[model samples]
Target: MEISAATMDDALHKALGKIIKSKKAISLDSTKGSNRELVGVQIRISDPRARFSRAISRSQLFSSLGELFWYWGGSNRLDQISYYVKNYRQESEDGLTVPSAYGPRLFALRGKNQIDGIVNLLREKPTTRRAVIQLYDAEDLDSALSPPCTCTLQFLMRQGKLNLFVSMRSNDILFGFPHDVFAFTMIQEIISRRTGVELGEYIHSVGSLHLYANQQSKAQNYLAEGYQEKVPMPAMPEEDPSAAMLVLVRYEREVRLNQTLPAFPCGLADYWLDLARLLAIYKCYKKKDRETIEKLKNKMSASVYEQAISKRAGQIKWQTIRQEPLNFTSQD
Candidate 1:
């Protein structure tokens, strides 16, 4: 079945509603876990930029950013990703790296840069259908662990806009769907900037779109919360965003390492600077320093991130208070 929506939340709500009620869905058990699986699902997001959802149940913004930077950096190390989402350690084979991580495949598969190749291909011929990035390799079958769920990403330039079509072998709707949309659509925007075109629709095709038994309750909670406003992220500057992206990546590494925040005048636009400040905010959150988090948050220019950042700050404050020792000897 196909679902078309204007934003990620809209699409997610529609897809979840269908999965919960569709008689065609089957209960299945796999090596991963038990889930209700639906085959051949296609979701098209009309506004690719409105990728984020304000669903409090999911709390996906932080982890989504982590996944995006992880993939963009072409990293497979477990330590790097586990810091953002602890559950990623479960996917690691040797407790060191995740072979199925798409970073290595997307950026450097057999020393061939598929991202660059796609950019070059599209720049040469806007209408070409060969601008494909292959993620699932033949050797993945030999591995003991599961292969990448995302098999391929195809980009098409039409009507002065760049569109992305993605095919996934499997998808955990409640878990994987949101992050995949955020990252892939960001890539689409990046490619559009590089190719000098407007951002277009995102088509996600999944062979198996399933919601695990463990996440069913959370999914229902998301649905119960009802509709949220569609807030699109800031547009990438018309100029080539590669340099700013590199700066963001570099600052991200520093922030993840708990290093000092880079000084201002780092030569990034306000758009990129706001993103860099978010990493700083995340750093402060990791340190459990609510004071610095608030300070960094105040510096952020993007209001789209305010809710998520505020929520995170509140969590850190609560955690700090909970961890503090309380004295009750006098009362006792």
Candidate 2:
């Protein structure tokens, strides 16, 4: 079944109902329940730019941001992924690194700066269908611990706006969907702003869209307690993603090292920098490094700070973030 909605939350809400109500469940493992599965679920969000979902944990939102930046830096840090996900990262026979890392492939797949190549392509030929980012490196499936869930991303410009179509081979609707939308749409916004186009529709086509039977209650709980979505997608800075790559990499490094927030201002735009700091705060949150969260909190944009910390009112994690939080009172 297909679902289309104005926002990701509505699409997910409907998609969850579709799977939960489906009788065509996966073959049961007595050890684990037959998680309901639905094939070929197409979710099209009218505004790819309206990606902020209040229901997602600050941890989930920022971790996805971290992963995207990690990939942007051309990283293959299975060690870092292992620490966050608690053991989903795969290693090669050498036991050193993930064989088919998406970051390296996306940024350095064709030697260096494929992102620049893509930006250039869009500028040179606005209507070109060849503007595709190949994430599925087929060669890795045989050896890599995890092949990419997302196979490719195609960018198109229509009526003066840039739209995106992401093809996913598999999508865990509950756990993975929200994170994927946030990260990819942020990338989408970056490209749109840099290319000087309006943010348009985001169509996500999944081969296997599913809900884990184990997390059924959690899904329902989220549905029952809805979130306040940030509508009308925000516009990112016109800063060249290529020029900003070096600075973005540096900020990530500083955050990972648990160093002091550099006294010198970052070279990134305020929007991008605030996003990065959210991820940094999340890392500190995981470490329960309250001092660091507090430090980074002070540097963050109050609008994003409140969005990251204050929503999902009763969620236990946000309770601490609420103490003397940044004043982004206008959540509209």
Candidate 3:
């Protein structure tokens, strides 16, 4: 379920065609320095997973509003948003501790109640459907620090394939378009997995996709170089029992880390301490080379020893050790 850059280019080309045929006059915004003008078609693609569908819809131009809010709004401590949207609320009860103020604006736009919307959608439509959540709130745009998007997203389900269509008011071809391509595609993959649907085409309809005056050189360079038409998608997981085991192992490790880490610690020192311990264990298990493992072990042991000696040192808590057999494959 990986997306290729060529697929992205093809979608962009299709969007350009739509815009040209429509004969729309796209406004170019250059308020920001460095000639950031809107150009090119805006498109979205989606599958079943509601959060994933929403992510694919918005990730194209700007990292999904959820992403912006998560990173900027200090809500990354837990996967509350993802859990809520995915209907795993029982498993994510810990997330209820997150303040309502931290919720992203898009959540409301999706529905009055995020969890209910997702659950109802899932129950009624067990099959994969193209579900979209939008964030261009008129009230927010009018009073906000930033302007809302002129274009809106529509998710379509056709023949069990999820397709995304974005109608953008403005497009900054050089700067903004690439983000839209990668983010939406990733969203496509996540939804595909959750809903058991194949990702089809991403349709973009751009009103104005332009390069700013200052970006002429950069645009020229891009035009001259031409985009590489094909990029390889990551290999899909194999269906063999052994392959399943590997995926399970990875998931288990992720769960362990998730459960143990404190809800987003404050600063670098705290982050480093946790990271050091995690890396040490991960490196020990993943690194096959004895030499590499030994080196990591020595470094980690020294760091732990130093911390123990420090006057500011607090309680050193270590979890019980569980060893799993390692299985290697050419894919690894």
Candidate 4:
């Protein structure tokens, strides 16, 4: 099954519709319950920047950014990622780290940085087919839990655009698909900028594209929302975003550790500063510092993040209410 769409949201809706309609039930030894499956599925996204879903239920904007930073930092530590997606703790073996984390595989696999290698490879030879990043290694087979769902990624420079091809062993349509597209496409754009080429389409190929039985209702709700207006994320600066990314990572650690934020104008462009501000907002949300969150929110330059931040703020408020101690006095 092949599906092509302008954005990830459209592709997700289409794929879910197909799976729900089929009603073919199958169980996996690795995961519990039956799942609706589509074998040999391929999807192409024309505009990778429109990666975030517009659906309110699927407002995974915050988690997606956390995952991207996790991968970029080349870390598999559960403490860092579990905050964003608590379920990731289940994938970790000893509650410390995930063995199959793509960060290590992509960056330090056998002591080689694939990101740098790929960028340099494309610069040296635009037409080379060897620009591939291997994620699933032979040693991963020894692990009992959390083998990589993705297999390999190949880059092709065609017609002056950098197209990315991703091969996955399996992809969970509801939880995994959106995050994968966002992170991979972000990498694609980063490479495109570094190579001074136009960003191109993202092609994702999966051996099994599936929706678990437990998540069917959620999937249905997403489908019932109808078509979402496509909202593309702001473009990255034309220059290499490596420096900005480094600064973003530094602030991410600061926010995560609840440290005082460094002075602004860290010599970064506004595009990157906005991302740092987003992280600060996330920290404020965690601390229940609504006042500071409001302050940071007003400073964001991009309007695309407004909805997600609003949603998160609501959630935090609800959580605070749930945690507040209630005193019951009998007035009878």
Candidate 5:
């Protein structure tokens, strides 16, 4: 079924409610755990565009964008992405890392640069329908510790606008849906800008869009919170989005290695610098240096500064909750 709305939250709310009405119950055993959920649902988010992108884990919005952008720039190092996204990847056999990370294939390291080529295709022929990036590897079906949910991303030009269409093999609508939209739409925005077309709809066609039993209640609460309140995330400046992404990647690398922030790159615009500074401020929170974070916060956009502070507070709260012993088990 298709649902249209101005923002992603409302569309997601409606989609979840529809799943409750229309989905079949099933259980599937997988790496993370057994998922007891309503299954076999397809969702098309009519307005998948973000105002203030959100995930069940709001912090994930920033982190996933960082990781996806890092990978899109043709870097396949999962450790780099894992550092930002907090996955803590365990090295794999055959000198591989993050066994199923999609970046390497997305850029076509095995064959061709699918993503970069896609940009060129759209730029050269706005009507091209063959602009595709393949992320799924069939060999991983049997061997991967964590198989990819996303199978392919298809970009289409319809009526002079660039639209993003993605097909996923499966999705946990509660925890995964928000982050998926957050990152994919950012991908759409970048491609749209690079192709010099206005951004259009985001069409998501999933084989199974389900809500695990564990997240059902919280998902309902999110619906009750509503989507009228909107926050705007700044769009990439008209200059090459790649330039800004590169700066962000460099800063993330330095922070990950415990190195001091390097001098800003020459010729990089303040648009990119603003984003890099946000990442730096987030690193201050990670280092638990409140003094540094305070000074950095003053340099950020008010909207961005507020988000960084809120996320930092949430991180502290989550860490506190994790430290507390379980009431029933620990008593023994």
Candidate 6:
């Protein structure tokens, strides 16, 4: 299923609302020191795209869905979730498995022909089955080298019904929490079709769902935008592994550019538009944080402008202008 930006925004809104309504604010321990918050929500939708993008982005530590799936997934990290949207086959052990908390485990299904393989697996084993992908590697976590995510998702098929259970250890309520729902649901949809099962409920169990004080105002603004009107899910594309690679290359370029010249003097909106165009051409993911981008752009531009003005003034006064414009009058 194709998940669009609007769909993601709606899912986030619903999740935030639930947390607020339940009056269950996440607790923060002073030891962590990271000013992050976590919020959780459960969504039931037929669309698979929404779920896929949400999961990968949250897991991969990227705010953009396209970037997460295309770039991070292509990097071959076993602890991260693997997606076979076009097929249902399990991944081969070969070189794909990585060392994790649960020993070396295959996080996602992998096969030569994903679609065909999944169909075959379902046909042969028509029982309640699960595809488990984990993010927290105990070794990595204990060594303090694990990524910021501590989440796992399980897709279960029982009696021709598909259900998703997401377990999160620490959620960034402001940014990361909402996207989780969308990602898992997408996985559930893909598994259901390959196995010919009906879509079921989504159960999200969050451990820490605090709202960061800094992001409180932004969260409120998002809430004011109101819930999105429900729409039909988009069509899923055929399985293409190359597409994932393309996503990674594009995202790498974006990260490099952003980090290298973060203070480039340019118009805020114009800069983002340029970046967006570059991403589209390279088939990378784009996000909807224009406000943040704009603010950064303006800061960059102001800094450049100040430097240029200072240099120009110095050049005119010290280098360009001499003591005086001497007039050699023919001895009048």
What Cα-based lDDT does every candidate model obtain? 0.85, 0.69, 0.38, 0.84, 0.65, 0.42
| Model 1 misplacement above 4 A | 259-265, 318-332
Question: Candidate 1 clashing pairs?
Answer: none
**TM value for model 4:** 0.92
Best by lDDT: 1
Could you give candidate 6's per-residue lDDT for residues 29-121 as a string of tens digits? 544343433444343443334342222122222223332443234334332333212110123244354232221222233323333344455
Model 4, 217-331: lDDT tens digits are 8998999999888889899999998888877776677667655544454578778878777776776677676656666678788988888778767765535344322111211
Ranking by TM-score: 1, 4, 2, 5, 6, 3
Model 3 agreement with the true structure over 1-332: per-residue lDDT tens digits: 11122355444334333333444434344554343323453344332112211111121211232232242233323453342133223223355532222234334444454323433453367443535444445564443233333344455556776566655565655544554444444444434444455666665566556556666565555444433333333322322122232333233334234523222222323323333333333323332333323333344422322321221112222225533322222111
> How big is the positional error of residue 151 in model 2, measured in Å on the Cα after superposition?
1.1
RMSD of each: 5.9, 5.3, 14.4, 6.4, 7.7, 15.4
Candidate 2 lands at a TM-score of 0.82
RMSD of 2: 5.3
Which is the better candidate, 1 or 6, if ranked by lDDT?
Answer: 1
Instruction: Write model 5 residue lDDT over 46-164, tens digit each, in one string.
Output: 55455334433333555655666666656656667666765436434444466666666776657887768999998888888899887777786886465777888999988978888
Ten residues in sequence with the least summed lDDT for candidate 4: 323-332
- Model 2 agreement with the true structure over 222-310: per-residue lDDT tens digits: 77766446454346666656556557666666656653343323456776667666756665565555554655667765454455543
Those runs of model 5 whose alpha carbons end farther than 4 Å from true positions after fitting are 20-31, 36-59, 87-96, 217-221, 302-305, 313-332
How far does residue 298 in candidate 4 sit from its true spot (Å)? 1.5
For candidate 6, give the lDDT of residue 153.
64
Backbone clash tally (model 2): 1
For model 6, give the 10-residue run with minimal summed lDDT: 83-92
Give the candidate order by descending lDDT: 1, 4, 2, 5, 6, 3
lDDT of 1 at 174: 82
Shift in Å, residue 1, candidate 1: 0.3
Error of 6 at 299 (Å): 33
